[model samples]
Target chain A: MFSMTIIAILMVVVMFVGLYLKSSPVLQEKSFWQLLSSSEWKPMKGEFGFLPFVAGTLWVTLISILIALPVSLLTAVYITEYAKPYIKRLVFPILDILAALPSVIFGVWGVLVIVPWISQHVAPHFMDFSTGYTVFAAGIVLGVMVIPLLVSLFIEVFSSVSTDLRECSLSLGATRWQTVRKVIFRQTFSGIIAATVLAVSRAMGETIAVLMVCGCVIGIPTGILDPCYPIPALIANNYGEMLSMPMYEAALMFAALILFVVVLFFNLLSRIILYRLEKRLG
Target chain B: MRISKSKKISEEIAKVCMCLAMLIVFGFVFSVLWTIFSKGMKAMSWDMVSKLPGGGFYIGKEGGFLNAIVGSLYIVGASTLIGLLISIPVVFFLNVYLKKGSKVAYLARLAFDVLFGVPSIVYGAFGFTIMIFFGLRTSLLGGIIVITLLIIPIFIRTMDEATRNFPRDILDASFALGATRLETLKVVLRQIAPGIATATLLSVGRAIGDAASVMFTAGYTDSIPTSLSQPAATLPLAVFFQLQSPIPEVVDRAYAAALVLTVIVLALSITGRFITNRFSKNKV
Candidate 1:
């Protein structure tokens, strides 16, 4: 009972603080809105707008999801319906290991290897690509970072489809491909969509790796080859320095609030999907 | 019988595709490991392991990672202990004390789910604001508190599973022997000590590897913390900070640190699996 009370008190306190920060007068000032809407984000010149950061975040996240979803889904399908048991075991462990790898490691790898390789070999190939730290490079790295998660979710959903359905299709003289397309894929479509949304959600919130590779430019990205700055990257790059600037701190809080809403939406969507799957299966 | 040739062809194609997919996944794993090994190996000398990063070209020559290593152990250990200590009681209360459909237990489960999904960075931001309010800024204690928050949900879920799976007949038999509820729990349920220990260890693994939550709340300090209130660095943060440098040596050390961190997580995960497997077999 005592511990329960403590937890309740802590929760209330946390919730109150979060709400208070969200509604703070400084955060409500018209100047804050003006600053956020302004195109100029030169903190040195005392101008800061969040438009470019928002654009950068959307650009990287969209590209990442686009690249990751198909590859991860194909990998999931291969594992669930085609791979032998021995191969499944090997692939699953590798996926789990990849999932467990720290974001910092990915960041270091991105900077040390990926960024340099792109700068030297890949960037010049694209028109208007003056720098290697483009949205495309960061998107590819982010895609790789999120692939394991999408693959696992897809596998779980695909595997949940009953074997009897597959057998029924097969017994009808359908090919294995036909069985997958006509039976398993149709049954697991909602799950696949849920997994894809969740993957995109994860891509949006990803920080350290994206921050390292995205060039942290404040300008809007005109193309995939242009430098970008994501919201998480902005928070990470500016949070330490923002301690001395109250307005910047407010901006960081604002960015965090936006991020929180995005994450919460994804979490809600995932939970709803999980609940539906459970109810359908039960 | 007439469709056998088409079936065989499709199966063959499927097998080939499966092989290709597995090879691609394995290729990614091999590449990551190879990159770490090739870059990290150069910084893996005994002195590097024994010393911290220092002056120019002093990749790992100032002081040993003894501090971060010990801090990591201490923070994770303390958090795991606190999390298990808090969760086991909650689990027992729900399973043994509370009536079915109790609001508190239901709320507890929901809260745990929310906690599980809350991103680590949000936790960091929340912890930073709250800890600073409580005058616990940049302290090892703050780090422990943040880690405790991160692991509590995991332990509660795991222990809930463990306790729920404990045979009801054993509890009944203990009660029939004139033992009270608390006595029955202490005597009968204590037998699952290994499973509980394994859950705690798994929580430890998570706490140890968590970098984002600890980054802001437990601001990095190079020196060893003299008190729970002092700032300190862990291996994860060390890698983060080192990777920011432009120096080749520091960068190399970062990869070496990554390699070390990965090994630790892998060890803990393997041990947890072993324990869970043993327990399942024993149950059977």
Candidate 2:
């Protein structure tokens, strides 16, 4: 059993080493830094600069976080401090089930409902693009996909802010809103931070839903309305044709490695903070 | 008087703002579900489940997704079985053999956490990488391996949470009986059997619903996979592929597939609720 755990742990190392070796062929052809910086990706011309995908990934993730954070925070606050018992009973389960809804379902919903609506109603008023498949659309979909995660984690965090602290704040002439804003939020700062970090990590790697709406255009998005290709979407869309094109597999592998590292770093950051606090308490 | 009134006003304002935000969140959830249900259920007929796609199925003719239904069941079932075999032992070692907060145990958990955050599409990419090196093509085996890898962290975490709740006195009681460490584990596992069941169902929900990890590896076929080496279809992939078809009938069928997928997942969640409730009573 102990050896099995070691093997399971070694699986992570295996993934890292395997990704490096697989991607090294491409890295040798083009320096890793160049791949990170260059934006062009024409498989037919054999020019495989993956900067656009990386940038798209970052842009969508950033946008989604910006859109999701405030709503999720406030929702968490309401659920924790204000929701009626019946509402809590209803809302939490919906969020939990929503979290588990297949991403492809979200993709289907996005393609059928959001795309047409955005393209028809919202796009005509805005800019050059009238298609619903924009970076902003993808970001909004991703934000929706991640809301359950943020709300659930934040609720746990807020609930753990000791009742004594809440009482003390309210007794000192603080309103319910002020008590939450000043006392609970401050006390649960680490938890909120961890939830946000984890949510960001989750959003960065979102593929199916993003793929359905992001238009899969392999260029850096100048504006949110412009279409873009995220790293995960790039890999999913291009992997099927990998055999027909040389260096395609390596290129996709490199993109996957970057996503792996970025998400890993954030997860580690959140884990370290929470783990340290856990140790301190004991 | 003025200050108190202002403070009360702000409280009222904050309450209204939060209430609106909650409403917005619920709006998204409700809309997503409503869209799927309304659009999806329209084309969801008995034939969609009972029959297999025929020659004109892609061209908007009458047929079913039995192939994908069986294939998804096969892939998710086999991979989950494998995942459980591996995850059970590893989680047991973490909680039983190691000291609390031991560096090795912490490293194991950390490794799982990192792996958990690696997106499923990346897992597909990684799985495809190894498959190519080994001179393997897209096959059910590939999807199984990748998916099992993808869900292992989830299984480990779920089971680990359950094992953590195992009472120390249970171990002591076993020790007092001259029971060995292995014996203690058996007893400990039984106490947390409900957690094991919940974890199994939850991971099942995850494994069945995911499309990306299996996208490249599980080379799609219109027929059910007969062996590990054979290509298999999955419901999520069916929904994706069918939705992309230009034909309206095929597109509606995609919604039907989505309905099937959603129903299965929601059912698993309900089962999870029942299992947790059933087990919560037994908690020490």
Candidate closest to the true structure, highest DockQ = 2
Which regions in candidate 1 have their CA more than 4 angstroms from the true location? A1-23, A31-38, A43-48, A128-131, B1-18, B52-62, B91-110, B157-202
Give lDDT tens digits, candidate 1, residues B1-284: 36777677877776676566556666766777677667777777676566654554345344445567777888888888888778777777777777655777656665565565566666676677777568776889989988998888778766776776577777778888999987977864566666687777667776887787788777776667889988878888878777777776676677778778777876776666667657667662
lDDT of 1 by residue, A203-241 (tens): 887777788789887799998888999988887666578
Considering chain A alone, report the TM-score of candidate 2 relative to the true chain A: 0.95
Decoy 1 TM-score against native: 0.87
TM-score, every prediction: 0.87, 0.96
- Model 2 clash pairs? none
lDDT, residue B268, model 1: 74
Error of 2 at A162 (Å): 2.3
* lDDT tens readout by residue for model 2, A171-247: 78889999998988877788789889999999999889999999987788898888998989988887778877658
State how far residue A50 of model 2 sits from its true place (Å): 1.5
Docking model 2 quality class: medium
Task: Work out the iRMS of candidate 2.
Answer: 1.6
